[model samples]
Target chain A: MSVHLLYAFAGAGVFTIGLFGMVFMVHLLRKLLAFNLMGSGTFLVLVGLAQHRNGVDPVPQALVLTGIVVAIAATALALVLIRRYFHLTGQVTLEPGSRDDEGHS
Target chain B: MTSWLLDGLVVFMLLATAVSVLASRSLFRAVVMFIAFGMLMALAWVRLQAPDIALAEAAIGAGLTGVLLLDAVAHFRRGPDKERGGAS
Candidate 1:
């Protein structure tokens, strides 16, 4: 197979692995890392697909650029919320089982 | 010829990074592995001829996100150091 196609397959494999980790990991930080890994894999696949064109695919590249910025903004906001939850509950909180504490406070 | 070999090598590194980021026990180690994964991902982007993505992945994927994660960890450590549902 061609190098670009091989790279695309590789990206897909990594994307699957990252997806598995995201769902299975218990820690909030690990979940965040896995999510980012999946994101990187998606970006790799997009860039790999762009390689098929004779020239740059400005569309995918621009979309991925916008995605990177949005990912950071979301991560920052999530981290802030994670910190706030930890401070209030005295625990490293995850998504589930934390709602009751919020209602009490 | 050599580019193919380099491509395979990078793919291996990518897989390894994924495994390490998940398998690591220490929270700090996992975060470091995640950063390394981001860097290797940038390399893959470079190899794929997307310099803009390489740049963004390096900056946002690795640089900015790393700061945010490390800050989160530090904030957690400064507190009571308890697990989510344990001992509280």
Candidate 2:
């Protein structure tokens, strides 16, 4: 297989892993990390698949560049929100009355 | 031959770091692994022949994001005490 296709498959694998983490993990910060991983994996698949077919296309590359910027902005906003949530609630996980919240309250 | 080997290695490292970022018990260690994952992703971008992405991934993805998350981790660790003090 071509190198780009290989990368695309790898991206799929990464995306699956991220999805698993996002679903199973209870911590907000961990969820954010998983979200970022999902974004990165999607970017990889976009560029990899496009390049595999079109031979070094600039369109997908440009798109991925903008995507990376947006992803960081989203992550920053999420972190701020998480900090605010923790500041008020003193708990990291989203679940109300979770085991982690027992001692804090 | 060498190129394939290098690409495979980078891909492996990328997935490995991604897994570790989620699997690690310590939040700080997870964030650190995420930073390492970002670096490996930059290298993967280079391998995929996207130098622009490689540069941005290294700078923003690895550098800026890493610092942002590290700060968040620290805040989360120490947040409850400060909150208690403020609340009372």
**Index of the highest-lDDT prediction:** 2
Instruction: Kindly list the per-residue Cα lDDT of model 2 for residues B1-88, writing each as its tens digit.
Output: 9988998998899899999999998888999999999999999999899999999999998899999999887677656567446432
Lowest summed lDDT across 10 adjacent residues in model 1 chain B is found at B79-88
RMSD of each: 5.6, 3.0
> What's candidate 2's DockQ score?
0.63
Q: Give the per-residue lDDT digits (tens) of candidate 1, residues A11-30.
A: 78788888998888766767
lDDT of 1 by residue, B1-88 (tens): 8998899999999989888988887777888888888888788878877788789889877898888887776555555444454422
Could you tell me the TM-score of candidate 2? Answer: 0.93
TM-score of 1: 0.84
Lowest-sum lDDT 10-residue window in model 1 chain A? A96-105
After TM-score superposition, what is the CA distance of residue A24 in candidate 2 from its true location, in Å? 0.5
Largest DockQ belongs to which candidate? 2
Give the interface-residue alpha carbon RMSD of model 1.
5.2
Off by over 4 Å in 1: A53-55, A95-105, B80-88
lDDT of 2 by residue, A23-60 (tens): 99998989999999999999989999998999898999
